[model samples]
Target: MKILVIEDDRLIGDGIKAGLGKMGFSIDWFTDGKTGQAALAAASYDAVILDLSLPAMDGLDILRGWRQQGHDEPVLILTARDALEQRVTGLQQGADDYLCKPFALSEVAARLQALIRRRHGQLQPTLSHGAVTLDPGSHTATLNGEPLALKSRELALLQLFLLNAGRVLTRAQLEEKLYSWDHDVSSNAVEVHIHHLRKKLGSQFIRTVHGVGYTLGDS
Candidate 1:
C-alpha cells in the first residue's frame, strides 16, 4: 500500500520510513506539513502518518485542511504529545488512529495494517485474488498452494494490480505505485515490470486495453 509520512524529526521520520518500507509498503516521507499536504493533494495514498509538531504548518491544520477538502483517506497521528486532550482533539479533527512516541515499530506497523484493512473493509490479514494469495505480513505470494518466487519489485507491482483489480491502470498510475518520486523512471519501466509479471502469472491475468492501459478480470 502507498503511505505518506509527515514528520519533522529526521531520526523519527527515517526510522518510520525504513520500518514501513521493510514491511512492503510504498512510503513517501515529507519533513514538513506543507510539503506533506501538497503531496496529499497531488497523489492518492492508502494512509498518512502525521506528526503534530511540524514546520510551516501544524499537523492539526494539515489534517483539518484535508478533511475540509473531502480527503477521507485514513490518517494515523504520531506525535510526542500524549495528553488525553491532544488525543481527543486529533480524533475530533478526523484522525483514524493515534500513536504516542517512544512506541514499538512493530505496533506502528500493525496499526497501519489495521487502518488500511479497515479502509478496504477487510477484516483479515491476507489479500486474495482468485487462486492467488498475498500475505503482506509474511511477504509471501502463493498460487494454487504453490509458492511463487517473485522479485521484490515484481511483487510490489503485482500487489498494486491485485489490490486494484478490474481497474484500468495507466502506466503513470502503475509507476506511482511501483516506483518512488526519487527514482529515475524510463518510459519502459512499467512495461518491463508488466512483462515480467505476465511471464510469471500468465498473460490472461492482465488484459491490455488497446490504447488505454491494463486491467485484471475477475479471475
Candidate 2:
C-alpha cells in the first residue's frame, strides 16, 4: 500500500521508508507537517505514519485537520512521546495506532499492517478466499497448497483485492494503494496489475464490472 510518512527526523524517516519499502509498500516521505498536509490534501494514501512533534506544524494539529477534512484512513503515530497521557491524547485525536521511538522496524511494519487491516474491518493477518491464501509476513500467496510466484506489484494488487474482497474497487482506489506520490504510475497501471492477477489466479477469481472496476469473487 502507499503510505504517507510525516517525520522531521531524517534517520527515522529514512529508516521507515526503506524498511516499509522492503515489506512491499509504496512510500512518500515528508520531513515536515506542512508538506505532509499538502500531500494529504492532494492525494489519497492507504495509511499514514505521523510523528507527534513536527516543524511548521505539530503532528497533533495535522491529525486533527485530517480528521476534520474527513481523511479517515488509518494513521499510526510514531513519536518519542511514550507517556500514557500522550498516547491517550493521540488516540482521542484520531490516531488509529501508536508506537514510541526506539522500536523495532519489524514491529512498525507489523503494526502498520494491523492498522490497514483494521481499517478494512479485517483482524486476521492472513487473508484467504477460495484456494488462494496470502501471507503478509512472508509476502507469499498460496493456491491449492502451492505457492504462486508473483512480482512485488502483483502481490500488492492481490493483497488489496483480498483485503477488500467482494467490494468493487474503483481504478482510483487501486491506484492510490499501488503507487505513491513520487512514483510515476502509468495510465493503465491498475489494468496491468489486474491482467497479471487474472493470469495467475484464474479469471474467475477477479470479476470485472464493465465501465467500472474490478472485484474479488468466487473462483
Candidate 3:
C-alpha cells in the first residue's frame, strides 16, 4: 500500500518511513505541510500519517482541504497535543486515528495496519493468494501448509506480489515498496529477489514482462 507521511522532524520521519517500508508499504514523506498538500492533490495513497505542527501549513488545514476536495482516504493524526479538545477537533475534521508524540513505532504500525484493513474491507489478519498465505500480525508465511523460509525483504516482496497478483509491477514500484528512499538499490536487486522467489516457490509463480516489468503467472 502507498502511504504519505507528513512530518517535519527528520529523525521521526525517517524512522517511520523505514519501519513501514520493512512492512512492505510504499512511503513518500514531506517535511512541510504545503508539500504534503501538493502530494495529496497529486496522487492517491492508501493512508496518510499527518503531523499537526508543520511549516507552511498546519495539519488540520491539510486534512480539511483534503476532505473539502472529496478525498476520503484514511488519515492518522500524529501530534504532541494530547488535549481532549484537540483530539475531538481532529476526529471531527476527519482523522481516522490519532497518535501522540513520543509514541512507540509499533503502535503507529499497528494503527496503520488497521487503517489499511478497513480501507480494503478486510477484517481478518491473515491474507492469502493462491497457495501462499501471510499473517501480518505475526509476520509469518506458509505455502501449502509448509513454512516458507524467507528473508525479511524476500518475505515483504512475496507479500506484495501476492497481494497484487496478476498485475504488472515495475521495478520502481517493487523497489519503492521494499526499500526506503535513502537506500541505494543494486542494478539487479529485483532480479535477484525474483530469482530467489522462483527457486523457493514454484517456477511458474511469476512471469517476466520483457522490457517492461513482471506479473504473477497464471497458476
Q: Compute each candidate's TM-score over C-alphas.
A: 0.92, 0.91, 0.82
lDDT leaderboard ranking: 2, 1, 3
TM-score of 3: 0.82
lDDT tens per residue, model 1, 1-219: 778899999999899888877777778999988899999888888889999999999999999999999999999999999999999999999999999998898888778878877787777888788788887666789889799988777777777777676689998788887655776889998898888878877877778888889988568
Ranking by TM-score: 1, 2, 3
Query: What lDDT tens digits, residue by residue, belong to model 2 across residues 1-219?
Result: 889999999998999888888788989999988999889878778789999899999999999999998889899999999999999999999999999998898888888788888888888889899999998777899999899999888989898888887789889888887877677888998888888888998988889988788898775
Better of 1 and 2 by TM-score: 1
Cand. 1 TM to true fold: 0.92
Off by over 4 Å in 1: none
* Model 3 score (lDDT): 0.84
- Summarize candidate 3's per-residue lDDT along 25-69 as a digit string, tens digits: 668899999999988776667789999999999999999999999
Better of 2 and 3 by lDDT: 2
Off by over 4 Å in 3: 18-27, 41-45, 70-72, 209-212
| RMSD score of candidate 3 (Å) | 2.8
How many residue pairs of model 2 clash at the backbone? 0
The alpha-carbon RMSD values of the candidates against the true structure, listed in the order shown, are: 1.7, 1.8, 2.8
> Whole-model lDDT, candidate 1?
0.85
- Look at candidate 2 and give me any clashing residue pairs: none
Worst 10 residues of 3 by lDDT: 174-183
